[model samples]
Target: MPVPKDNRPLRSPNEKGRYRRAWKESHGNLLLAFAGLIFLIGLAMIWASPPGTPEIDVDLGTVDSADQVVSLPPNVILIRVATSQLNSEGPIRIAVYDSPHTFGNPEQAIIKDSLVPIDGFVVWEIKLDFLPEQFAIAAYHDLDDNGELNRALFNAPVEPYGFSNNARSLVGPPTYEQTIMQRPTESTAIEIRVY
Candidate 1:
């Protein structure tokens, strides 16, 4: 007998398995090709991306030395700071403030600050660019090398510290006027004893 041309359900229970296997075999290659295309597109996007830029280093304190010349004043003061009873042989921090605003503020009077490392003795001969003016001195022995004076939890100084004219504070550090020391001549020697 000839096969019927009518669109009736021809897949029986036994033929359904063969039909599914044939369908998978035919679409397997297409599915693999689609996945390969997606992988190639991803690789192409990654290769076409721009390279990252290198990091740059910048110096904040850089200045043009050619245009600016540092000239010493005609009447510069040469002050010799001698320390006695320094508990430790570490760096000695000395600060000079010519005004009340810069008295306890080291950042404001940074130019007048000096850090001298004690080499078997405690004496530092520093030169000031300014002429004779009202100035105050605050010195401290940095025993911990932390660049600042270390203090206790109660705000008391843990390191040996002293002010000019041997000024001491009852509750806190000496004020601007109390620690003031005059420079009578071009050069003078001021001795401070660390407590």
Candidate 2:
């Protein structure tokens, strides 16, 4: 028996080595290109991930200043917030940043979902694994899905902004010093206004 001939042309009949040569030249680069594509895909997934938000019981009394203490022995922290009203769904994120680790950096791993509902006179307590001399607390509602605090094009706009100790209000994020609060190992309360 004779083998049948494949009549159809794999490449243009006129071209001698177009297809095979192209594949040979591109084969090595193809793997690198594919690897690069995979890396980019991984990066996209990480960037698109939802960042965990923290919920701290805001305990605030309209005293001259705000003072708080971390429950010692166990180093448990208590946050008492006193607010007149709540944003419909805004500035819902409150973060406590540990200083020296960088400002506005969240020290607690407690995310802001499936914990407590925003009721009147919100109170939250968290265990302090490591206490720092100072930290910054921020409460904000992520209205836009872009994440991070939203600002105007000129880097100027009035959005929901709050800091530890109810620091000075700004059209944008406040300076590092203003947001810093002394974290002593005692029950301390910082006054914050709901934006």
Candidate 3:
């Protein structure tokens, strides 16, 4: 019997197996190439966009004399922080948030400051002339100097922290409204005590 061109039979099973293997190999190579193209496009998009916002540093040096403090403009806000655990190591980090969305996010804070702990009170004089009329503050005693509010199991803070107006929360952190304060038209002082 003569075999038709479309119905040709393989001489051996090995020939049939080879045909299937070649088809599978070509499909595998096509899939790999498609995945690589997607990855390259994603990388190019990331490179074209700018990075996230940079942190704003609010350190303006220390004021040792009463004259220096008096010289500060009326827009200056004197933040007097009192911590019972003053003996703990590391600086006291403060973040000022102008909006509720940015609250608790130190990176999004309009103003950020860090102060060395003192025996009586650690003060931070921040000029808020450029800030909004209303803002909230979140401060933490970074005992580990790791620049983060270290937490243990159940998300309980290991270090002492406080908010403006000395706000307290039964569950988690205080809401932005609880800690919000009006910007003073003149030089004014506010206190925050960290537990």
Model 3 reaches what TM-score against the true structure? Answer: 0.61
lDDT of 2 by residue, 1-195 (tens): 233476664544557777768878989678879999899778655533333433445324333335554333345565544333343333245666665345554445222321122653344565554545766676654544334666666564234445666665323356667877676675454455434
Higher-scoring candidate on lDDT, 1 or 2: 1
- The ten-residue window of minimal lDDT in model 1 covers 53-62
Q: Assess every candidate by TM-score.
A: 0.52, 0.45, 0.61
Best by TM-score: 3
Q: By TM-score, highest first, what's the ranking?
A: 3, 1, 2
Query: What digit string (tens of lDDT, one per residue) describes model 1 on residues 22-98?
Result: 86988977888999999977865553332343322222122556855343333444343444433555677777778
Pitting candidate 2 against candidate 3, the one with the higher lDDT is: 3
By lDDT, highest first, what's the ranking? 3, 1, 2
RMSD of each: 24.8, 14.8, 16.3
